[model samples]
Target: MLIRSSTPEALRQNNSLSVLSALRRQGALAHTDLCAQTGLASATVSAITAILERDGVIERLEQKPAGGRGRPRVLFQPKRDCGYLAAVRISSDQVQYSLVDYAGRLIDRFEEPRLGGDGATQAFGQSFLAALARLAERSRLARDQVLAISISSKGIVDPGAARLVWSPVFGGAALDFSALLGAVWPARVLLANESLLVAQAIAAQREGQGHIPAIAALSLGHSIGLGLARRDRHGEWEVSAPNFGHMQHVAGGSLCRCGSQGCVEAYAGFYAVLRTAFQVPPQTIPAKFVPIAEIDKIAAQARAGHRMAIYAFRQAGQSLGAGLARMMSLFGSMPVAVTGPGLRFFGLMQEGLLEAFAETHEGRLNGVPLILPMTGEDELVFEGHVTRALAEMDVMLATGQGGGAP
Candidate 1:
């Protein structure tokens, strides 16, 4: 509700962003379609597009008539070589790096195994910077040519300062990305929670299809992560990733890696399901990794009516549902998209998950928002990183090119 109208400069930014957003969503729009998409006048679109073209940020595509008659229709699209972006996704076992062009096309990508956390913070930072250099060099681009670097990880991220505050891998060793990238490149740095990127990508996709009130993207895997994304009145996306995994579920219950007891991750995470399936003592240190094969076995057993496996999956679902219900109670009702590797086993947990939701007062009032199982978390996550980074880059280029300000 604190959201306010854009001021003079902000209005200009909105105008530029609307044009860029239209091109990004609909792809290579003619001036007429561009006006309709951005809800701007033809003159405004022409002015902005002209500035964009003059600054080499966009190019005009000519469509020849079928019979070579009359005039050719012209279209505007982002110039692929105008800028570049890098996306780094840090996971528990490995780090993935992808280079994308201004047109949101992938140029290059690779992965590096994450070394053991035997005092691995600074060392990992070194390797990551080197990887960035490799990413640029292999793509034949100078460091400065990469306009932005977007880093996503499964932990706490300070988007304002571009820092990794808390992560399952590094624990208390926080990494400030701006400081790390400051020396080698002049590009801006952005750090965001992995699930947050997923939400952004999904939000953009939904907006392209039509209006979406709000949605929550829940990641279930080695850990539980939650992200909420909504389009505000201004048609700008608002996204946030809460540390839903570590949030307390049952006080003084199972031990969590973050030194917390009774966190939601302690019950619903993959490790939690494994622990429950094996009836491991709640106080034991959680496993760093649980192979999906083991979970598959457990799921198979649960499907065969194995008592312990059934109970384990049911427990995970109920705990997850309770935490989500609490979230819905705080926020308004919204559809939930369950993503990540955990979707493979959702069939085992849907019953208990729904039952627990139905028990909540919020669920009773709202009638349990739609719970959809979404596959390909990786695709959405990468798409999100590019979408966010490129959007910011668009603002930078458009303003620098004299397109934002009147």
Candidate 2:
């Protein structure tokens, strides 16, 4: 376990954060509401909110009571223009950029095609940086106004410096995200795995609804992604995106994009399902992307009793289920929120998935974990961006490291 000593300055900042966190979670909470939610004294809440309002970080609203019965209730919310944030979500073929305000509202967004897609044999930093620059210009936001830039990608990322350590498309090459933007912009940089954001969104959504259970988010697409979200000792969401796709599944069995054999992705990825459906050799290289229409046609065949197609989905399901069982054994059982483009084929994968999972020792002993199929991966990802990016902004302002000379 890790521990750190708190100083006077840290304690003061934490008190401010507690007030801001209450407003964020409860949405325009009143002075008394902040006190209740944050467990802070009414005096402390008043002092913090006054400081926040004076610094232009938040604004108070006057709400009239129903039927004009009593005095208006005062509420506080983050100022819409306290600062700005840019959230970039990188996918196989495209990059999406969204400009968000301090209140975590989307102001503008656009997408641009990635240069190399999955064959990332060259640097994309030039185009990527250009896009970000364009985003700020388009939004008419100045350097200091942009408090933070949060990015997500489908690869291993460095949590602190926001580096893309290793990507399936780029192989061993890494992308220094923080440096790429540091010289051009003053905003703090944050990076997270794509699925990690998914988990964060789920966890944020579950807050205040009683206890938030530990859960795993499993994304099925061109690659398999897994993220775990649990509450920390302080009751904050702690999230991680493990390289679940590349974890070993069968010894020396099938080829993976990472040049590894018997990886879970080699069996459960979209290309793997396509390969098995077509009876392709295990040694054959997987395609970078398979059209959903093609997968749908195969699913149609599977539903029509096509032996190979049925077997293909079954193989993918078994691989995913087996991997999930091992995860449960190691991390203890938890609900799995399954999402991604691959969910369209869940109907075909359900039977084999459950069957294979039930066969595992962990599954048999503790029973299979609840598996929920969900949609809107893209929306959830952006929600995650807002939840995390705003929290960071709150701390920056509380620490006097944010915009408007806070």
Candidate 3:
């Protein structure tokens, strides 16, 4: 429900954004193609492209060979050397850093062990700063060459400020990344939930396919994550990562890592499955980390008809289905994309999931066919980061906020 102004400058920026968006989606394009795709006049396209090329944000390609008669056509694409982006993906065990070009090519990447203790936040900040410095040094690029820094984590994040509002690792201690990096780094900082980026990648991939009003993505692991991407009436993309895993599913039922009772994550998270199959007391605080190998063993046991393991997976599915059904009740049913390391056991959980889903009021009333598509969580998360970061950079370019380096 947000309204945007359409002033002269705003319209020009919108046109430029449209051109950049089209190029990003379709790769290199001729001026005529840009005009057609963006609905901008030929003159406007020429003007925008000229400015972008002059600013070093985009580059003109050599003229293509003509088929028969007329003059050769010239193409344009984003200039790879014009800007760079640094991506930091923070997880419970490790933090991954990647350097990417304006064209979304990965230049360099590395992972570092995550530090944890009484002063975990302070330790992490120092480590993060060092990591960025190392990345820039390795890439042989000055700090100012990095136009943007995108950070993703498994927690509630402030959409505007690149801040971790609350994280399972930090609990009540929030980290404001915008202020942290703004003090020394001139690059723009963007923060997002890991799974939200997964949803963003999926939505961007499936753009203009059909009348898909909305899509929901679920991530399953030591913690649960959910991302929703909706196409509004004006066809603008609206995305969110509601602390869905923390949503109360059953009152006073089981303990959750967030120190709550019967959150969806209590039953659906990997640790929850371990607790259930091992007959651990529900009141016992769940383990902070659950290795993938442990879950794989459980999946193996369930495949071999182990009653406890099968029961544990079914319970997790029931919790997930119920949570998703509740979401459908509020947002209406749409296709659901399931990702994360936990999907390896989807076969064991499918029956319970569908059965529980069918029992919900939204599922029964809407009768919308459910499609649970599997995807690579890591790849999607990184792609989503690049997509979002580049989009923001495009807006900056359009608004004249970005200028060529001396």
Whole-model lDDT per candidate: 0.87, 0.87, 0.86
- For candidate 3, report its TM-score: 0.95
Instruction: Please provide, for model 2 over 14-38, each residue's C-alpha lDDT reduced to its tens digit, 9 standing for 90 to 100.
Output: 8888787777777798888888988
Q: How does residue 16 of candidate 2 score in lDDT? A: 85
In the range 182-237, model 1's lDDT, one tens digit per residue, is 98888879899999999998887887577777899999888999999977877678
Compared with the true structure, model 1 gives a TM-score of: 0.94
Candidate 1, after superposition: displacement of residue 161 in Å?
1.5
TM-score of each: 0.94, 0.96, 0.95
* Order by TM-score, highest first: 2, 3, 1
Clash pairs for candidate 2: none
Q: What C-alpha lDDT, on a 0 to 100 scale, does residue 251 get in candidate 3?
A: 95
lDDT of 2 at 299: 89
Model 1: clashing residue pairs?
Answer: none
